[model samples]
Target chain A: MIGVELRLMLRRRRVWLCWVLLCALPTLVAILLATTRLAPPPGRGGAFLSAVVSNGQIFPAAALALVIPIFLPITVAIVAGDTVAGEASAGTLRYLLVRPVGRVRLLWAKLISVAAFVLLAVLFVTLVSYVVGVLAFGFGPDASIGGAGAIPSLSGVELTPLDVVGRTAATVGYLALCMLALGAVGLFFSTLTDSPLAATLGVLAFVVASAALQPLDAAAAIEPYLPTSHWLAWIDLYRDPILWTNLREGVLVQLGYVVIAFGAAWANFSTKDVTT
Target chain B: MIVATSGLTKRFGRVTAVDGVSLQVQEGVRFGLLGPNGSGKTTLVRMLLGLVHATSGSIEVLGEPMPRRARTVLPRVGALVEGPAAWDHLSGRANLRLLDAAGPGRARHRRRRVDAVLEQVGLGGVDRRPVKAYSLGMRQRLGIAAALLREPELLLLDEPTNGLDPRGIQEMRALLTSLNEAGTTVVLSSHLLTEVEALCTHVGVMDRGRLALSSELGALRTPTGRVLVRSPEPDAVVGLLDGQVVDRRGDTLTVRGAEPAALNARLVSGGVRVTGLTEERRTLEQVVLELTGTGNDRVDRRPREAVVPGRSRGAGGPR
Candidate 1:
């Protein structure tokens, strides 16, 4: 069922359009940084921008940083939101339920498909950035930067080729999990309503809402638990000592959401009346 | 009984959609659930299929309790709920393929089975088109093909001809009848009396969330026409009759399950002078309306008012 759903989801022109949007962001960042060499203001994508200016190999890290706030989460929201609500609104959920698939099993298939979408979306952005970076800026030994280190020559150094590849994989894998947590949120909301647009917006709202809360001093105590809080923690992967504290917290938080969100989704969906 | 529900009720908030409907559909019979638009036919069907949870009461399908053992029973019983609902983005064949995958496992012949069902529903060559592009009739056919994909022993269809053209309706009737003859017990709900009259052997008519009547189609179709008599003493005349009177006016009444000679003799003996006597063979629609009280508003007036039917009365349909 998951395989079948994935195939169906992938066939949609909307899905392909989302993929294009995801891949385009990183490619744009690479193209702009490669041509202009103008430094992004100190706080933003500066570290990644500087890294890209120095070595093409570091562009994937830069791309992941640039898009974590909006583009990637939005793409995930659309796919995950459509998981169950789309089927219900289309009037096909009843047919699927009437088949041998149990509601629990069907829920699992939808979750898996959403998680798969997250994986594909995140990987596409990273790969596009890497390819464009290599072609334009030129590849070499990669740069290593600490968490919160998006500036050039400021707490940044070079790394071996193997380290660059390995770190890039870990960065993407970790970010994918964070996006999967968001996907689970969308899936849970999908089960709650028959409007796919509403579910997608709800998930997007979570990401935006959490990120917006980051500016509040009082909200800091509750900040670490938010899915957005640790998104940039992936930059730790490029550090020399490889800081795993924030990365570990990020993984655990994502996994925690993955479990709770899915458990909630199943609880609601398994016994849910197929009214749509 | 292949399908049975005892005191099955479902209430949507303040409205009781299905009020204690206990239905029994016999095996090897084409059963029709007749009702107006919001008569709870769809709700009852949903409960039977475990698509909607019953507020109370038990439902047994094919000798097994439902919404509990639904996983075990549903795969064996196919259904087209409400109307044709399919994945519009998918090709008809692709939609069936996915549904069949979720159905009983027949790994190798799955493609062949899909092909056969598409051909059976007359979607054969056109099934490869995206469902979005298919006409309503084609979508309905695809829905039927999906339901028939598993070779289910029992098929539950809700308003199957809702979106079909006349030709499509005929083809659907023929398809279902042939399938029923092939030993599939069919339980269908429809407002299309013509289709039900032509296809169903038994029926359960629903009105205002209640079963107004349930019996064999033969029992429902009484060859005897209703006895209408106009008399000055209407109360005295009604008091003289023993059988149920279908409709009543100031000096006129239509009596059912009655005899003209006996009624006339009874009225005359009772000294109730009558102005007119006639036997009107009521159509099935009139019988349904009278029995169901769907014509309650007009039926209330005691004069010769046009009992304009077809439009719903005080009680509104489901939103």
Candidate 2:
């Protein structure tokens, strides 16, 4: 049933085109980042891509975070938002449901499809960013110890290229999990609303609102727990001795969200009348 | 019986969509569910297919409880509900192929069945065209093709004639008849009385979430011997024989309590001629309308009503 669902979803022009964009967008951005080298003013090259510096962790992370609220979430939103509503609106849902496939199988198939799209989008962004970042700045690991900090030269790290790539891939995997949570939340919203715009915007609003609160001094107490706050925990990958606490908490929160979102979506979708 | 529902009931909040309706579809029976709009026909079909949960009562398809084990039963059933709603972006063939893959099958069997059903439904020519480009009638045919792909033991069709041209309806009727002859039980819903009259062996009429009438079509035919008379001189005939004019539809006359033989005898005797006289065979449409209580608007008022030339209102009036 899932195989059929996946095949049907992939056949849609919107889904397929979005997937192509997901694969290409990051690569295009990477090319721009690498080729359009805007040198930092004076001694600013020493500063890592942090939030405060013109070209640092903050710049790239903010860009990536912005992409999260927009770019990456669209893939999640398209797949998730289309899951039930698309079927209902098209009338194919009745046909599919009348087949041997159970509601559970249908929901799982959609969840898996959304999960696959999330992974594809994240990998696209990571590969393009890594290749472009390395090409522009050199193929070495840079360190941004904290927010607004300097990105140390890669010449000092003792790790082999293999170790660095392996660590970077692992970090990418963690980030993918965070994005997967967004996909699940988007799916939950899709089940609640029949309009794709509503579902997509609903998920984006949640992510953007959380990100908006992170920098506020008064919301400092809740900032650490926000999906947006932990979104950049991947920066810990550059730390000489990576701290697993933030990564662990991020993974836990993401997992919790995925479980809850997916559970809600499943529960709502299974019992949904699907009148459309 | 292939499918049976006992006291099936479904309610949405305060409104009941299907209210304690019992239905039985026997093996190889071509059952027609007839009703006006909002008569709960679709809701009942949904319940039988386990798409909508019944609020109260039992439903068994092929002797198994519905919904609880609907997956097991679904493999043996096929349905085309409302219309053929497919992924408009996909080619018509791809849509059929995708639906075909939902059931258990091998690659070759799936392809063969898809091709066979497409051909059967007369969509063989437009297999590669995007579904969005197909006409409404063609889309309905494609939906039937998708439904018939598996050759299931039971088939459920909802408004299958809708959007179909006359030729398409005839083809569909013949196709369903043959499928039933080959041992597949079918449950179809349609507002088109002609389609049901020409195809179904049994009919069920529903009104306001309740079954108003259910029986063999043969039983609904008005009793024989009552002749339908159409004459411009209805007054002369009425005055000569004092025959009760049951109803007047344009120049036609429905005279009850009178035999054609007696009416003919009295007309000749009184020198009042009748232009046309034919035996009235009640159409399924008339029976359905009257059974559903939507025929009350039909004015049967005429002073020359009740009483016939040869037969009185007492014993064997017409038949």
Candidate 3:
């Protein structure tokens, strides 16, 4: 089942198009930063902007952070949303089920494929950005800088190349893990409806609502647990003597959500009528 | 028995799609599910395949309980439900290859199996063409190819010839006949009575979620047809004939059971004018129409059931 999904997803021309666009965005942005003397206005991705202009090597890290809250998650949600609903809508879910595959196994295959897609998407964007950053700008020590408050809670921190490398890996891993939970939400919604677009948009709507509510104190009590709230916790990984607090919390929270959300999906799908 | 369902029921809210449908399909028999639209034909097939859970009762497939044991049983059964469905972007062969990969069994020799099915379905030459380019008939054939991949012991097809042209329909009929002859129990749901007559050895007739009749073809079909006579005094002729006259038109009469030669002689001796005399056998289509009280076109509402004669072959088979 996983093999079938992989073949179906990877062979689609649009998937490749998405990859090109995702990878190209950061590279183009990095090139623009390296060539221009203009600095982004303060307090709005400014620190990451300054870091990108200072050293090409920091481009990958900056790009990954820039897209973490929105672009990467949206892409992941689209693929994940389409996994089950697309098949159902196309009237293929009936055939797939009649393959006699256990419902849980089918759901697991879908989850794994979405997770694979998320991993590749993030890696592609980060890898291409790193290469572009190195080509456009010179590689060397990156600024002890990132988006504002990336490490504001901590001080007296310094990093060598190896430290930066290690922290960056941790950050990427954190981002990937968080995205998996997001993908699970998408999958959950996929089981509820036969329209992939509707499922994806439903996940996006939740993300948007979470982001919309973040600034308001009224929603704060539940805000911390929202996927949007933990989405950027990887920023803490960049701090030397890396702050493990929110990163660990974020991991636990995301993993918890994955379990509950995926459990609900499996419960609903296992006995679903499969009318399509 | 390959399949035996007792009191199987499925209710979609207020509408009971399948109601206490107790049916059976024998091993190595060509069984056809005959019903009018919305009479639970598709729903019954879906339940048998475990696509739709039964609301009550039990279904056993190949000696293994259905749905509960569907996972194990399905791997040994092939099905084409509600016409053909395939990935439009993939070539016909690619689509089959993907399904074959997902089906139970070793991947080895699957390539040869695909080739054989494609050839069998007359799609060997066009297997490379993307499914989006296929005509409806071609796609239907592809669906059949997918079902045949595992060489399953049972084949379930619902309206398999819905989109096929005359030639394609004939090919499908021939394919199904050959498959049954080779000992694969075949179950198909269709309104094409002729197709069922030509292909099935046994039939289960349903109406409004109830089985009106299920029996061997030979049992349902009478031994002889009636003598149709055209006469100006048709109603008068009804009185003259001692045997029962089944139907009457403005100038014609259909007399059943009585030999045509005897009826003609009686009519001539009775001084009745007979313009035309011909023997017309009762067709499977005629039987279904009379049973369901429906003509050719499908009707959404389940017509009231007709009390058809003949007992169903034992919950399994005549044997």
Candidate 4:
């Protein structure tokens, strides 16, 4: 079942379209930055955008920040929301159920497929931006500051290229987990309705509502628990001595959402009548 | 028995879709479940396939309880419910291969199994065109091919020939008959009486969510004990038969109280030229119409009663 779901996902032209669009946004940003050479002043614009003009190694982090706010979530919601509801609307849900694919197994396969999409999207954006970043602004001239070739962290500490690579890998893993939590929420909505559009809209509404409430002082008591609150915690990965506080809290919160949302999906889907 | 359901009922909120339908299908017989539209035939089939859970009742397929043992039982049973459905973006062959891979089958045999079913369903020359490009008849054949991929012991089809042309329908009937002959019990649900009449050995009629009648096709169509006679001299034949002539239309008379052979002899002996003489048996259409009520799709308002000035006033007003 997992193999079938993965093949179906990879075979779709829409999945590839999503990857292209995701990579396109950062590449477009790279072009403007390379031509203008005008990096936003510190504490303005997307995180790491002010730093990308000097160190190309930090471009992946900057690119991730560019898409994470809206583009990444929208694409994740589209794919995840279509998981069960798309099949239902197409009238193939009943056939799969009768094919003797257990409901639990089908949900698991869908979760894995959604996770794969998230990983692929995140990885493509990072790799494309990395190449674009290096070409637009060659490896930084600050190699003499620390050992051989080193880049400055968010702090004044100069870190080697190897350290930057390791931190970017950690950043990739963290962002994937955050998107997966959103994917689980989308999966739950997918099981609630037979219309894929409706399910996708529901997930968007959820993200929008959560993000809308995050900045309000009135919502401060429940701030840390919101699904979107921990999404930006990956920025701390660039600290000289990694800031584990928000990173650890972010991992725990995202894991909580994944468990709860997935549990709800399994509970609802296993008992659905599959009338379609 | 291939399938047995006792007190099977399903309710969708306020509407009862299937009500107390106890059905039995014998092994090795082509069972046709006949009903009008919205008479619960689709719901019953979905329940049997475990696509829709029953509100209350029990269903047994192939001697094992349904849904509970569905994983073990369903692989041996193939079905096409409501109509055919497939991923419109993929070719018929690709769709079959993917569905075949979804179950417990071995990977090496998937190609052979898919090809065999496609050939069986008359799509041997099919190309790589996606299902979205296939005509309705081609799509229906593809659906059947998917069902046949597992070589199941029992085949449950709902309106199997829905989108087929005349020749396609005939080919489907022949295919099902040959499958039954090879020890596969076939169960099909259809609203088309002619399709069932030509294909089924046993019949079950559904009316308003209830099983109205079930019996062998040959048994429900027993001789009606009336003989039809056609003679050139209608007046002489009617006069000769007298009280035995139940009905008359031109030169043809429906006569009772005599066998076809005896009636023919009497007509010939009476100096009447008998063109045709045959016993009248009940047709499947007649039996079905007699047993079932009007299809649920129809709605008729009751006639208002005329009110006298002195009678109760409420009864005459518009409802």
Candidate 5:
């Protein structure tokens, strides 16, 4: 059943369109940065945009920063929100249920498929930006004090290229988890309504509301619990000593959301009458 | 019994879709569930397939408790509820392949089974066009093909012939009849009276969420205790039968209280030429209409009393 679900997701043109559009944004940003050679001031623009002008190897991290705020979440919400409600509106949910596919089993397959999309989208953005970054700005000169072929960390400490690769990989994993937390929320909303558009909007509203409240002093008490609050914590991986404080808190918070949201989804779906 | 439901009922908030429908369907019989629009036929079919949970009752299919053992029982029972539905972007064949793979079926014979069912449903010559491009009749056939993918022991179809043309309807009737002949119990819900009368062996009529009548097709069409006689000399036959003649139309006379054979002998002995004589049996239309009430779709306003200036009380008026 998982295999079938994956096949169905892979065959959709809309999924591929999402991947193309996601890659397009960062590539466009890389071109403008390459041709014009104007980098956002340090500590002002995206997490690593200013650094990418000197070392293209860090562009993948910069690209992650570019999309993490908006592009990635929108695509994830669209896919995850469409999971069950899309099937219900298309009139296939009842057929699948009667096909002897247990409701719990179906939900499991859908979640796994949504997880796969998140991993692939993050990986594709990381990979495509790496190639674009290298072509637009060749590898930086070996000028760092740490060693030859090393890049500078956000903490003013020099790091080797191999270390850069390892940090980027960690960043990818962290961002994927964060997006999955959002996906789980989307899944819960998907089970609540039969319109895929409605569920997708519901997830978007949730993210926008969370992001909106994160900055207010009055909301500071609940800020730590918001799902979007920890999304940028992956940038901590680039620190010289690797700030584990926010990263650890981020993992726990995202894991909590996944569990609670998926639990709610299952509770509502298992007993659904499937009138459609 | 292939299917038995006791006090099966389902309510959607304030609306009672199915009300205490204790239906029984025997094996190897083509059971036609006759009803009007909004008569709860689709809801009942959905419950039988375990798609809709009963509000308070029990359902048993293939002698196993439904929804509880649905994983085991459902594979042996195929169903098509409401109208046909498939992924609009995928071809009919692709849709079938995906649906077949979702259930517990032999992976080795997946392609073979899909092809065979498509052929059985008369889509053998279909091309690779997406389902969105297929005609309504083609989609209907594809829906049936999906149901037949497992060679189920019992087939439950709701409005199975819904979008088919005249010839397509004929072909479907033939296919269902052949499948039933091979020992598969067939149950179909339809609003078309002629469709049921032509295809079904047993009948159950539903009205306003209640099962009004259920019996063998033959039992419901019992003789009406009258014999119809057609002769060249209609007056001679009427004169010979005297007061037994209940109705006269052209060259035929409806005579009560006599069998065809006895009536024929009497007419011939009385020097009357009897061209045709046969006992009258009730038509299915008459039987269904008699058992059921006005269809739920109809809404009539309250009748108003007549106001006349000079007419006294007890005067005749439209009731």
Candidate 6:
């Protein structure tokens, strides 16, 4: 049933287009990095691939990862958020509900498809980061420390190529978790509203409001607990000493967000009178 | 019973859309739900399908409590509620294929079924065209095809003849008749009384959220013995009968107050010549309209009840 739902989502032209464009962003940026010499440090043609592959900070892939939470999540929210609302608006939800399927099963199929899309979006960012990062910076080893020295990094650790891949894979895995949670937020909002636009905007509003609230000095005490504040915690994966303490907490917090969103979605969707 | 509802009511905010309406549909019967605009026919249908919540009363479909979980009943029923049912971006065939894929029906055989229904609905050659490009009539046909994809045991169609040309209406009428003949129970709601009279075996007339009348098509029709008598001696007939007259035209009069013996005896005794006396009676349209107040002014003011039938289709389908 989930596979069937996923097939339907993939068949949607708008959703497919959004997925493809986001997937190609990193690849496009990598190509540009390889052609241009404006890359800082480790100068010259040889450094091009090395710099490009490891260029998560300046390349389009990294830019997307950063910019996506601000914009893409809203788009992601729209896709995930409109999953149910869009059907209602199109007058298709009633048709679907009349099928020989339970509401729980139907909702599950939809959620799974949305989760798949969210993973694809995260994988899009991760793959671009890996491809361009390796091509521009060389697979020599990700030695650069990200932000504070919390998690371990390959830059100064002198690890093997495979080890670096393993570490990056783990890091990408955590990032996927955070992204999936955001997608769930969109799903929850989608279940609440009958209008596709309202569902899409509602999810974005929650994320944007959280982002806005994170920097408020007056509410600094509660800022750490905000869902948006922990989005960047994936960077902790590239630290020198590997601070597992805060990293584990970030994962838990992300999971907590997923639980709340999905819980709300299920409760409301189960009872929401599908007027359409 | 294929479908049954008792005191089914739905209220949106403060307005009672459907109020205390009870209805029943027997198996293999083409039941027509008739009513004027805002009479809550659509709302009742929606609640029966579990598509909308009923504010009060209980509805049982296929011998099971409705809306408790529609899964058991949904598989046995197919419906097309107002307008074309399709994704505008998809081809007509693709829309059929999608619906076909969702149910227990086999996807491999779906193509053949899709084609058959399209052909039946007069949309055979345009399956490749995007649904958005189809004309209103074509779209309506496509919607019917989509609804028929599963070949369910029961079909609920709301004004399936809207936008159909003369030939299309004839075809649709034939198609519905054939479906009923094949043991597929049909419940259709239409404003065209003539259409219902032509196809449906049973009908339930609604008046402002209430079931005003429900009976077999044959029973609701006018008696077979009445005669339509037109004469140029209206005043003379009125004076001669002394109260047996039903209606007086410009110079004509309809007399249903006497049997053949009494009518002929009185006419002979009065020395009045009868020019024409046709035995044909009223139409279901006349009966429905008169009963529903659409034909109140024109209705025969005698003791017999006015059988109103014709009402806007909006009162029955999705509002």
- The regions of model 4 sitting more than 4 angstroms off are A143-149, B242-251, B301-319
**Model 5 misplaced regions, further than 4 Å:** A143-148, B235-258, B301-319
Query: List-wise, what DockQ does each model earn?
Result: 0.58, 0.54, 0.62, 0.74, 0.65, 0.42
Model 6 alpha-carbon miss at residue B232, Å: 10
- CAPRI class assigned to model 3: medium
Q: Fraction of true inter-chain Cα contacts (below 8 Å) kept per model?
A: 0.78, 0.66, 0.58, 0.73, 0.71, 0.44
Ordering by TM-score: 4, 5, 3, 1, 2, 6
Output the lDDT of residue A157, model 5.
Answer: 94
Q: Model 2, B8: alpha-carbon shift in Å? A: 1.5
lDDT of 3 at A18: 68
- Mark the 10 consecutive residues where model 1 chain B has the least summed lDDT: B295-304
Error of 5 at B117 (Å): 0.7
**lDDT for each residue of candidate 2 in B135-170, tens digit (9 for 90 to 100):** 999999988887787788999999988898889988
How is the predicted docking of candidate 6 categorized under the CAPRI scheme? acceptable
lDDT of 5 by residue, A1-276 (tens): 898899999989999999999999999999999999999999998889999988888889999999999999999999999999999999988888888788888998999999999999999999999989877876777655543356789998988888988999998899999999999999999999999999999999999999999999999999999999999999889999999999999999999999999999999998888888
- Candidate whose TM-score is highest: 4
Clashing pairs in 3: none
Measured by lDDT, the strongest candidate is: 4
Candidate lDDT values, in order: 0.83, 0.75, 0.81, 0.92, 0.91, 0.72
Output the better candidate (1/4) by lDDT. 4
Model 1: residues with Cα > 4 Å off, grouped in runs: A41-46, A141-154, B225-282, B294-319
Q: How would you encode candidate 1's per-residue C-alpha lDDT over A55-157 as one tens digit per residue?
A: 6767777778878888888888998999899989988888888886788888888888887787888888888888887777765443344222222322466
**Higher-ranked by lDDT: 1 or 2:** 1
Residue A175 C-alpha lDDT in model 2: 73
For model 5, name the residue pairs that clash. Answer: none
Across B218-283, the per-residue lDDT of candidate 4 in tens digits comes to: 999888999989888999988888899999998888998898888888889999998888889999
TM-score of each: 0.85, 0.84, 0.87, 0.95, 0.93, 0.82
